[model samples]
Target: MKLTRLITFACLLFWLTPVAGQSLKSGAANNDEIIYHIFQRSFYDSNGDYHGDLNGIRQKLDYMQQLGVTSILLTPLYESAFYHNYFAADFEKIDPKYGTMADYLKLIREIHRRGMKFYMDMETQYVTEDSRWWKKAFGNTQSPYSDYILWDDKENKKPSTIVFNLTGLRGYDGVTRKITTANLNSEASKAYNLKLFSYWIDPNADGKFDDGVDGFRLDHMMDDLDNKGRLPHLFQTFWNPLLAKLRTINPKIKIVAEQANWFSLGNEYLQNAGVDGVFGLRLCFAIRSFDKKLLLANADSTLAMLPPGKQQVVFIENHDVPRFSYGVKGDLTKLKVGAAFNLLMGGIPAIYYGQELGMTGTSANFGATDANEIPDRQAFEWYKSDTGKGMALWYKQTGPWKDQFNDDKPNDGISLEEERNDPNSLWNYYRQMIAIRKANPAFVSGSYKTVNNDQEHVFSFIRKSAGQTILVAINLWDKEAEVVINAGGNAVNIIGDVRPVLKEGKLVVRLPPFGVGAWELK
Candidate 1:
């Protein structure tokens, strides 16, 4: 009781609230939201057909819960022609490949039952050529839907960015099947989009907010989220108005933008347009650079840039980029170091499914072809026995590309089947770090300050809130490193693997080649 009293006193002295009203009102600092981003088709296949479906994800909720995932972000489920599902054909339908509307509602209920949030990825900015609107407008520009589609010519250009597709309609990897960019300037498009977003949020039209997703990942959103220059004022005009309506329907709904690119960070998006968060692409690239100065500077600048009530989702790998495991060739020590940095950082952290097991896969080129995004979207590798089955390598023997075996993929027994049994697996490393983040409020939502260290390869920082201070030291190298951090207190070695001593009031520790050690000092 006395020890608890002393600890409480220590924490009270260094209050977590940097701003009293902001901290007390929303208590955003206590929001330790961690999302597991999944390309549903590749996660886990429930049936024998090899395509992962809603039931597959439902079966794996236990695995996600065990890993401490508080929410999930799935690739778009709307009916579309391609495997990635970015091009929506029918906004009202859940792709048959995935399952029916009943399956979706069941998944949502199961997710809510387990006390997890669901966030859907929505790309209402464009639609496939066969869309009802596109089909009607393509042949007859005089159709009522004419104003909804963006055409290169009023009557005859055929809408081509890929020879015959317009810029917004043609996907980078050549996947958009004659995409018809929605005209945000048109009231018709705005009404259609609002109804679509609203339908998913409250499908039954009953007052209960339980049936719809808790949040949304607005894909490829730009001020010109639809297409640049076509409608410059769309965001300030259409999006702000639409989002305002959404808030009225479900006030707690979170809206995060996958902004156009890495340099998109700034206060303008959140302040002017009112997006809840944007991808921290700049920080993500820096962390992947494997450089200490840039990594530290970028992280500091980013956290400092955000105004309260806004967030930047931090991640090392995602569906769009090459796997982090591939960057380091699946080295266990390096993977753990990166894991420590990612989970401990204050911004909302996300894990691309299989990132923990050192999964390696990517479709690096942006050329027009089949499953141009397939390599990285490979199966979750539940078992080591079958390579093609259950994996979402849908492009195998389909056409322009063949089966790509990622040489960097972890060796046999690294699959979930094996890692679940092994105590010291990379998966276990992620599990531990997430558990630590959940246990320590400072690690997930506290204020961040860099801990200066003379060692060139060592990067250290202090994450503090209330009175709890967490010192995270990372060695971004392949050799053993001895570093000293300038923090003093009654310290508890957060991770048991390495013990740091307090000599003359400073913490001293040694990090193995690419090792990480976190400490709790209060």
Candidate 2:
């Protein structure tokens, strides 16, 4: 047992297809959008430089389709000195390391061609000194973009470290210089952002809408714009107005905000910021930890805060935190439980690129540079074979945690090459669960109702829509248990090896540790 390994949609029966006025379809919720979020530099490399690019992602569309993903979320593609690309050097061009603007445009066209949604992540809150506005307007009162950037003093040239304030903090070496915050309220800033944002939604200028991205992920989204939460003028003056303008240009273009301090504070952004979706970080943690009570309470409380018509993005892991697999110490059974919860949960289910492969990484000590968090964004392990073709260890010798990410670790239960065909692997578990969800529409656009089961180790719920319902039962234990979950339905379809016999209208089954099953009710 030595090392290494690893490892949609339809529409319209007069259903939620894009209409003439709406560029994005609603009503389907996130279940209809199985999002695959990728950090480009760590994905697949097509250029042989060991750096992944837009072309690399385009090359893997078929692989994504095979895995049942209908949407893809890419980290910010704008030119940047930072590896994460959240702080942009230029909002208009694709980073040369990624490829040309031509290549990016081509990728977008292909993604939409395959009936998939493409979402590009952007911060729009900060920019590097290399930005055109920063270069021209810093300490220059006469320049048109002078107010576009925030300076510590009207006469000072150095940009304020902004909200997160990394200027003086000491850590890794990448950010030797400071990144300035954008004065979001300034007409010049909004005007510039609007232009950049507009171009991505309808890149061809034809207004066909199909050729460009379907949405944008607003990174570090907030209502006040600062940690103090005192500058509460932006949502009313900045975001709402800007989003309204964008909607006028392309009504279906979706906007999702990564609410500032998302795990604890997101409802305000969703309720007042006018964004289409916000990340449900609290719920994500609940599922990952297998806290049944907390998971239910948090989900119900958070969902109640959102006004009807708004949705939250639910995921087990993203680029920001440690991988779920690592959180559970790479125990494959727990990994399967986490996967089932994420994919089958309510709201939009986003899959971090290598999450399905049970990839494990941690970056708890982030500092001056992305190098501090590099381990979490390690290259996708394409195979245990060739050391290079798919092993995109772009930050190998540079990051602080490089040694911690050696893919050769024994019993990793990771790597796409290792898990692609293994029936019991985490990769296949995701595929099977996704298939079950897709076949049952209720799981996608249904109402979530918590089912009370007397057994303490079993957690249950029903996803119901119209006349159909599917009860999902999960065993959050480490040992097999024979239990009866009081789901008022007969099993029409069963998943995994565990089968629950119906007795007195209750589901009775002996489930292995961390087992999951779904029943289509009569």
lDDT of each: 0.74, 0.75
Q: What is the lDDT of residue 157 in candidate 1?
A: 51
Best by TM-score: 2
Name the regions of candidate 1 deviating beyond 4 angstroms: 1-28, 156-176, 225-227, 364-366, 387-393, 406-411
lDDT of 1 by residue, 301-417 (tens): 566456677887889888877788877877888788778877887788999998987788755453444344566677787765536445654444344444444532445656877
lDDT of 2: 0.75
- Judged by whole-model lDDT over C-alpha atoms, candidate 1 comes out at 0.74
Task: Give the runs in model 2 whose Cα sits over 4 Å from its true position.
Answer: 1-31, 168-175, 228-231, 303-305, 364-367, 397-404, 407-413, 497-505
Q: What TM-score does prediction 2 earn?
A: 0.90
Q: Give lDDT: candidate 1, residue 505.
A: 82
> For all the candidates, what are their Cα RMSDs to the real structure?
9.0, 7.9
Per-residue lDDT of candidate 2, residues 52-122 (tens digit): 89999999999999999999999989887777676777888888989998898889889989999999898
